[model samples]
Target: MKKKIHGFIEKIIENDIKKNNQMILRTRFPPEPNGYLHIGHVKSIYLNFTLAEYYNGLCNLRYDDTNPKKEKKKFVNAIKKDILWMGFNIKNITFTSEYFDILYTYAVELIKKKLAYVDQLTKKEIHDYRGTLKQKGINSPYRNQNVQKNLDLFSKMKNGFFSEGTVCLRAKINMSSSSIIMRDPVLYRVIESKHYHTQNKWFIYPTYDFAHCISDAIEGITHSLCTLEFQENKKLYEWILTNISVSNYPRQYEYARLKLEFTILSKRKLQILIEKKIISGWDDPRIPTISGLRNKGYTPESLRDFVQKTGFSKQDSLIPLHLLESSIRKDLNMKSIRRMAVIDPLLIIIENIDLLHCENITVPNHPNVPTMGSRKIIFSREIYINRDDFKEYADDNYTRLTYNNEVRLRYAYTIKVTRIEKNKKNEIIKLFCIYDKNTFKTQPKNKKISGVIHWISKKNVIPTKFYFYSPLFTIKNPDLEKNFLNYISKKSKIKKNGFIEKDLPNNISCIPYQFERIGYFIIKKEKNKLTTCHQTVSLK
Candidate 1:
């Protein structure tokens, strides 16, 4: 409902209600319950729901479950959960299959009116006959069958008398029409799988094109919005509605679908990832699926802000991945509380500090929002700092700890490293430092501090696995490759056994916290087992 770039679609809706007293804005988010909802679907989801809300109308969450082979109740539930997570209230939950009886009758009426027929053409023959734009399509051998015969054949198809794909009912629209969707598109098909909603009561099912327009009409949806890929199908959509006695069928409008670089929006490709064990599951943090993003610490406000900022338009464009990140960064910068994590811990022994001298340091939960209060972190003789925060070598510009360099500890005393300890392989295992004995925050005379570094007491830290997640594909435009998987980022997810302050929250509830120098992270689970967490974004 946020004000975005106004396009012609908004004008159309605004003008429609302006003209007629009876006009009411209604919309629906009709998703095929074939797989879990993904990020691409988010734009359409919020658009439909928010538009209805903007007009003081209602939005329905409808599952276009005509294809029972891939559709399942679990998928329906998952989609519902995702929509709810987006912060919208869906009052009407309907399925296209719920109108199967009416839809079947409509098919019968179309056949009776000689607007449709059952075609016996094989799959290859149908494609061969559909003819390219340069050539006109040849009529199917069964195109002129009598309405009675077509009706009987369709009835037989519905009764499961024929094997799947043996025959299907097709609209008898102009075969030579330049729009291929109008070249006698399939209106009904034989899907023998038991539907999750209707069980085995029906064998033949209406195709997406056949059910979608009529469903919108039946629901009295004022503006049926779709992605630009279906723009060509609009003619067929209106034609079906006009011929089917839908007195007040909804008008269809097409806008660009959300496309992200290094991401595939195709449900089929996402299913491939699940099928081949390419990733963990539908909710893999690497995937563009909504559940995946939600688990990866994405907030709904950030998602909505992302879509609104991207703006709705008719022309499609591939969006940079950083645009999405920017939205998240903008959202979390004001909210995510600061925490300290040492992913690659280097022991720092403060030789001058002991149990008696050590004290608890209090830091603001959020530097900007004092209302979030503060948390206490302990300091002791033995503590851990990030290994990258120190090195055996240094330059004048080096802002972090180096051999014999003085640096300020975040929310703690200043220290000067005396020596670095290494193991047999020459890995810097620890650093010995002497802390300033001053009881107040102070700058060492004759030296400006290098930089502030975050550390935790070695005695009271909790070790947890932190996952650094990047794009699933290595290349920016991965979908261009014939084998998108060839560009799959092997290091899309990297796990580190990290240490966090012992006072950190045990339950995250999907809220991400900034880990000081590290990125934002949220607790995640795999297969019901609490597992490695994910980095939502980096500080830079």
Candidate 2:
């Protein structure tokens, strides 16, 4: 079934279809490939691609790789891989560099029409002249240069005659206009750095504001979708397209961008984390990058569901991180195989059973999913359980293991703790327990066992490392701080030794598993004699 489209953007598109009758909707996701894509970009990707699919239209993935100073071929490739990982099979992949010749022609057309001029103003001078929101901008002295002279200068700028930042092509728009973006925005600038795609082919490149609208028009895009931050720039987008000779003029619409709690999506900030070695890379599970979440075992379905629930809106708001966690939890609950793992393993010896005895117990892979089948787990005289599951003393409300208390072992017998062994420091080392042989599927006569704990036999267990991830930032909105790095969580990631059922596949693959009482986790890396699993979310 086609997903119902009912956002404000959808209303606009529906009205446009009604007005144009036969308009074939076309949208594009234009990303500047300087860093890995984060969850914020996923929202845009979901919106554009899903809208196109729903309207029986098309969406294109375009790289707005105009800034050669930071953009790289590696980033371009990473962006493509991330999109594909999100299950978007975009065939119309393109780059702004591909349309450089035509963009240059469009700039020349604007210059010849006295709509653009070559400015020799320094960077600071241009910034000073642009004016703030409270004050109107002053016109540049070069604003009135003749079309012939401007054209000669622009050609020279493009031909590498001008040094970087010395010359730029600015549109001849109103300087005193209420919109600062329309106050003669720079259309092109000279950059000496070699572009990843077109190395040294041209000395000048178009700014995003200039190249974006023209690129949309050139590609015959009917609806240009953007975040609300671009609302002020919409006027410039329209003005440039209106002045250009393009056959098609795309309309720009703005919606709220994703502002996720506890994480900053700024590429510059993320890069800083990388440069400081604060994270392994962009894919560090603690961050919100798409690859990071994937590495943490988040499914594409959950991310798409998150975007859908976030919805489209005109007003900006910060989305709670739990909303995303809830989506993934709901998804993993249905799909993940159930297994028993002990993060902080505590030894428990069943005294009644023979030390050499081992029994095979059958457990469903997924309790609700019968078709998922079942696996046999070893039940031996000695087993391991999470230290958190056992308490030396507990209140009546505590249902987990306690000294002299009986608790049901998941898919096994009910066990009663007889005693505990402690180290010299008073830390509990292990527990000695006795199991009721007949309580695997029933309560012991005249007694109720409300607590059920997961356990793995000490025999044939896979030694594993577990990573517990918390929010990268300590505050709800780290972006509010002048230096977001100050709010970095000291314990964002905690690693510990653990054990998983021996029945687990040798190659666990990327699929996550519900670690019974612990949490959902997926195999992250495997080395000789040890496997590493990353926690996706806690059982709660």
Candidate 3:
């Protein structure tokens, strides 16, 4: 069903290309350098780049750094880093500020033709004049000013003749049009603040709506694709090009933006979270930022697969994060080496003293993959298992070990509980068990067990802190709340004294591995050198 719909959209794209053969199809991923790129930006980047790839065209990375108040060079660098991490390379990296001189000349041309004028009305007054859909807007006092006077005033405004917000250059668009965006939209405004890229060369700057269209045309872009929010501005986009007499105007197309369950895509809200220290930073592993995902154990191949499987859509949709997670799990399950780690450890002591010595037991890197070889893990009189694996009493459905119940200690002999020990808090601290030596590999027994759990010898255990990370939000749609902070998950705990098997490699980097029944984790390196191993695990 989805393929048929995508094929239909593909045909429209093909027809567009056929009609405009003179202008080679070129698209762009333009983002404001005010904040870090999130998962939503990933979708946009993917869509534009994928479309360009399909048409055998080029994709440009254009930074819409028109707003100097909130943008910075740091954000520009971070955005570039993110795109590279996502395995995408743009044909060129450009900025809207690069064509400031050209845009200024175009603005002058508009003013000389009596199509624009410098207005002295305050922002509030301008808004009041630009009435709602049912009402016609009031004309500005200088709307009918002479072309020569308007040009002189615009030049003076550029030379810092007017204070910030005291003057603005607006295009003389329709005043009675139902679309509010066409009611003499402000093209350029005076901002005294220093820009991150262009610096203090000019005090006046062009707005996004004005700068974006011109930049696209200047770059010879064929498809000016954007989110659905810009659908209403399509007419104005064409109007700007028509009035300026641009020979080859780029075609504008809108698609639904990506919205994911349990993720918020608002840059303003994300900024607030960073400022308030609610998150570590933009690249915090808990965050959905591209860098964050990379740090959290996501591979480029996995991300590309995830995006391809999700495909494209016209209607707004909230993708189940499960789809992405499933892809990662499938990719990692084949690649990640198997290891034993007990987060909440429960002691299991052997009843027989004859099996007190440590024995080297070999285990496969992956269950079905033998070429990957095996690692030797020690088996001794006592072992550490998961606390959830045992109970004083059990029903038939309980697969793990229980009182007097026998279960295989994964890749080893089966063991039965002999006795249980409890502490002052009435919590079971340890269990006494005995292994069936007759079931050793040399003399295989015909006995069968319903469940098998992983374990490491207590004497050869590596005690360390395991930081378990879950999703930052408790709900599916985080942005739906009036205050996203209210939906943060407070139950996400960090265990400072988690345990792992002795067989785990020393000083492991951010390597992904399955923790048996406890899901996947990657080792997080810490600043302080703790002699004992410490790892942060992001559970899948």
Candidate 4:
């Protein structure tokens, strides 16, 4: 049995290598450096890198930086950081701009073969000629231009003779084809904007369709993996490669991108949010960006597990945010220390108690993971509890501090609510309770309690500002809408005043915690030492 198992594994490995010999199944993650990567991009990066690892292949971090107008160095750097944070190391790094001369030569070759031509039609006119969903489409007048004229015009385009968008080089594909991508797509266009890498060496730039395939060929990439949205363009991608004399013909494969509820994955919409100041930036914690998830205390292990469980599917699916959060909490629970914090503080006075001696309450860092050990908490006469935990009216089912309710002080003793103190306005200002110290569990007595609550020392409570973030948009699907900006929610906010226990010293840094009974939180170090965490509960 053991010999057979090893044989099967070896056979699979041998087949993978035999099928892709020279390049060894090389894959490239070609992201346009226009914005920071989001959760969907995370899925793509993980899938590409992991597949490379699976067949003992190589993965390259290739930037599809064709549109220099929207691309930036900051976005490229942030993308690199996000991929690294997700535990992927791409040794071969490249950019589409690096192969500009080679791609221009390829275009010249296509023109020499009369497969492409220089189009004089304006951008709007070209779009109109391409036809709409209800139209059969019309061909441009320049489609049948002379091959020598097309070559000369293309060279002039590279020489900066024409202004941006005045002329464009397009493939002479069938205009009446049902597939919209086949309708003589623009191969190259005049972009007078200064590029970050290539600079002013050329005035014309290749479109994504023209540049991407050439880039893959240049890197000797064997597998060009992308999202399913490009399925229609697969033919065009192959056409570009078949026309060019490349040593290896890379195959383009597409998979459905990850879609999550209560989030927007559209880069354009996300960019609008940043430009309009609807979000702090692309890395805003509210955003589904890789940086945002990292800042939210999500472990790389959790992200990997999420991608693994979701797997690769041909059809698009909407993943619930809770599924991702559950994965994060499952990992964090084993590592995060249990801490007590009162978000909405209410004074609790344990009357008839002496404050001279401070009691030490020992609590384990993790209950099931015993190796984490324990910490000491100082207990005193007065402490702060959540304001929502107490109420003036209640039914028999109410176990917490109602008018005269009885509850246990967690690891301490049981306490009975004796009276309620209020101001002249008849507000429930304070709760007066008497502790039955004899009923302590370690030193037991004949007493019982209905419920227990988390409390922090009033004097030890640190007042810090907390930033609470929610979904950036009001709609469930921000990408589906024609106007993404109109769905922006005004309720997404940042609060600067919140409190936590003083004993949590290490938490003063940008640390995170699973606040007992209140969901996860992090100690944010903005202007104030605030505890910022996402609220798991919803308004619904």
Which candidate tops lDDT? 2
The TM-score, computed over Cα atoms with residue i paired to residue i, of candidate 1 is 0.96
Tens digit of lDDT per residue, candidate 1, span 1-540?
456444677788888988985777889999999998887899899889988888788899999999889999899999999999899999999999998999999999899999999999988899999999899888999999999999999989989999987899999999999887889999999987999999989989999989999999899888899999888888988889888877777888889989998898889888988889988888988888999988788899999989888888888899999999999989999889888889878898888776555577788999899998999888889999988898678887888898646788888788888877889998888888998767246665766788888888887687778889888898887767778888888888888887877675656655678889888878655565545557988876
Pairs in clash, predicted candidate 2: none
Over 1-540, each residue of candidate 4 has an lDDT whose tens digit, in order, gives: 222211222344456578757547688888999988988998889877876776678899999999989999999999999898889987888999889888988999999989999999999999999997667789898888888899899989989889887999999888898888888999999987888888878798999989988888888887677788898888998888888888877777677789987789888888878888878787777888888777766778888888767777677888877778778777666656667777667888888678664788787766787886777766678888888888778888887877656777666777777888899998888888888777765435455455887777766677755556677778787778888778877777656444566666554444446667666666655555344544422212
Q: Give model 4's clash tally.
A: 1
Model 2, range 356-470, lDDT digits (tens) per residue? 8989888899999999899998888999999999998888888999974689889889998888899999999999999999887787579878589988899958889889999
Q: Kindly report which residue stretches of model 2 are placed more than 4 angstroms away from their true locations once superposed.
A: none
RMSD in Å for model 4: 3.5
What's the true lDDT of residue 276 in model 2?
Answer: 99
Ranking by lDDT: 2, 1, 3, 4
State the displacement of the C-alpha of residue 71, model 3, in Å, after optimal TM-score superposition. 1.3
For residues 1-540, what per-residue lDDT tens digits would candidate 3 score against the true structure? 223323334666778868777646688999999988887787778877877776678899999989999999999999998888777876789999999998999899888878899999999999999998789999999899999899889999899989999999999988888899999999999998999999999899999999999899998887787888999888777888888856668888777777878877888988888898988888777777877777777777777777767766678888898887887887788777778888678988887745658888878877877886889888888888888888788887788998745788877888888888999999998999888887654325566565788888877776777765567899998888998899988754355565676666554664567777666667654677542332223345
Select the stronger candidate by lDDT from 1 and 2.
Answer: 2
**Which consecutive 10 residues in model 3 have the weakest lDDT in total?**
530-539
Q: lDDT per prediction? A: 0.86, 0.91, 0.81, 0.78
